[model samples]
Target: MEVLIRPDADDAARTVAGIVHQALAEGVRTLGLATGSAPVGVYRELARRHRHEGLGFAGVDAFLLDEYVGLPPAHPQSLAEVIRRELAEHVDLDPARLHLPSGTAPDLFAEARRFERCLTEAGPLGLQILGIGVNGHIGFNEPGSSLASRTRLKTLTDDTRRDNARFFGSIDDVPRHVITQGLATIGEASHLVLIATGPHKARAVAAAVEGPLTATCPASVLQLHPHATVVVDELAASRLEQQAYYRCIARHKPARHRY
Candidate 1:
């Protein structure tokens, strides 16, 4: 795993956008996307590049990380609508190629199974962009989620719901469940890029990067991935015990290396 500590969130986003640009240059065709405050800057930076630098997503297939179970498709706060407004509308990515979990599927369980089957049948993701929850969860796979889990429905923890309440207006308004790609499902991606920021994320970042690989901190599953990059601002990297080493490693990385 590679840890990159940038000066601030915008800097980290730009650096991540560079990595995505390199992947696109290398012909990456499938992108796994995340939605949250942590990754919004990255999407915005990518959009800016698309508008000004000729960067494009015309041929890319985007797969969203998760969706709330009870939200309607048109709900403004729904992950689907969020991605559409924040990314799809701003990029050249074909709408027909974008895939999001069916939050309102009549058979939600079947829908989850179908999504996993379709993902694996299609092949590994070119890249998976991620955002770490304050509690160290990835997607909606909260603490205690099985390390080898697959796409499935999961109940949202109170902590997670509370964190997301800002978008829904109140804690009680937040969706209680969601459909998320599992850790094992996410692990199938050829590359994993996790973005996190702020002092509030420091402990989670440290636990993910330096703590033991355990389901207690679900994001720690990245440690088992062959290619994983953890991008964060200095504030988020504060709790990492090997902060100096991480900085030195990033500083010495070959200029041409993507991550």
Candidate 2:
């Protein structure tokens, strides 16, 4: 695992965007993505790349990590709509290649199952983009989430609902249940890029990078990944007593200067 601490969020976002483009250039046609403030920078960077660098996703397929169960896919707060407005609509990626859990499906478990099968056919994902929850959750995999879990619907913790309440008008509007890929599902990706930012994530970030690979704090599972990169801003990495060690492993290569 490698950790890259940037001066701030935007710098970290640009760095993540470069990493996304690098993965794409390496012939990765399928991307597993996440929805959260942490990965918004990566999506923004991808938008810029498409607008200015001719970065194309013509052959790329995208699979979202999770979505609220009760929310309509058409809802603006829905992860599907967010991706459409934030990234997909602005890019050249084929709509047919965009895959998401069907919130409208009568049988959500079946929807999740079918989606998992799509993943098997489309993947193992070339790159899986992630966000570290303040509570050390990943893709709605909350505290006590099993390490070898599979795709399924899960109940969101009060803290997660409160954190996500900012996106909705109120906490009441946040769905308690969600369909998310299990820790095992995310772990199957060939490469993992976990993005986290802000002081809010300090303790969790510290636990993930420096702590043991345990299920108590789900993100700590990254410690077991062979090709995982944990990208954060300084504030998030603040609790890491061994900052220099992580820094030395993540020396940056400027996107502009790389070619």
Candidate 3:
């Protein structure tokens, strides 16, 4: 994996946004999007490009990473709504093209199958955006999730619930479960870009970037991807053991692979 330590969160976001913009410019149509504070800046940067730079997403199709199981479709905290508010509303991306797993489906298992099928039919994602949770989870695939798991229902861990509770009025309002794209499913993307920032994410970023590839840290699975990029701010890279080496690698990146 390529580790890029930017000066700050905004710089990290721009680096990620540049990768997405380059992909779109190269005619990549499908995208895997993650929702959280980590990716909010990237989304805003993309939106700015769309408005001022004429960057367009006219025919692009985006698949969200996950959604809360019990939240109403219109719930402000729902991943779908979060994406709409942060990214879609600011660009030309069609609402119909932004696919998200159904959180309120009566038969959630069937919904998982259907959403997986939908993802398969849409063709391989050109890029998948990710955000690492404090516990080192990706999507909602918490610790102990099978490394080879597929799209499915997953119970939220207490740590995850507490982390997300800030989005809701209270911890009690947080959903207990979520439907997420598993590690195996996420690995299918042609390019994976994980954005992380803030001091709170330092340890998780270290585990994911340099720790062993175990199910205990689902984000660590990125280490196995042939084309994965971890863009982090200085605070998030604080715990990485090989920070100097990573910086050297970034500094001497070939011109053809500058993005």
Q: Which candidate is the best by lDDT?
A: 3
True-structure RMSD, every candidate:
0.9, 2.0, 0.8
Writing each residue's lDDT as its tens digit, candidate 3 over 101-220 gives 989999999999889999889878999999999999999999999999999999999999899989997889999989999889999999999999999999999999999999999999
What does the lDDT come to for candidate 3?
A: 0.94
- Candidate 3 is scored at a TM of 0.98
- Model 2's alpha-carbon lDDT is 0.88
* Per-residue C-alpha lDDT of model 2 across residues 1-259, encoded as one tens digit per residue: 7788888999888878888898888799999989899787789889989999999999899999999888788899999998888899889989989999976679989988888898888869999999988899999999999999888888999999999999997999999999999999999999889888999999999998888888879998888888898888999989998998766655554554231
Of 1 and 2, the candidate ahead on TM-score is: 1
User: RMSD to the native, candidate 3?
Assistant: 0.8
What shift in Å separates residue 65 of candidate 1 from its native position after superposition?
Answer: 0.6
- Model 2 ranges with Cα > 4 A deviation: 252-259
| Reference-based lDDT, each prediction | 0.93, 0.88, 0.94
- At residue 181, what lDDT does model 1 achieve? 98
- Which candidate do you rate higher for lDDT, 1 or 2? 1
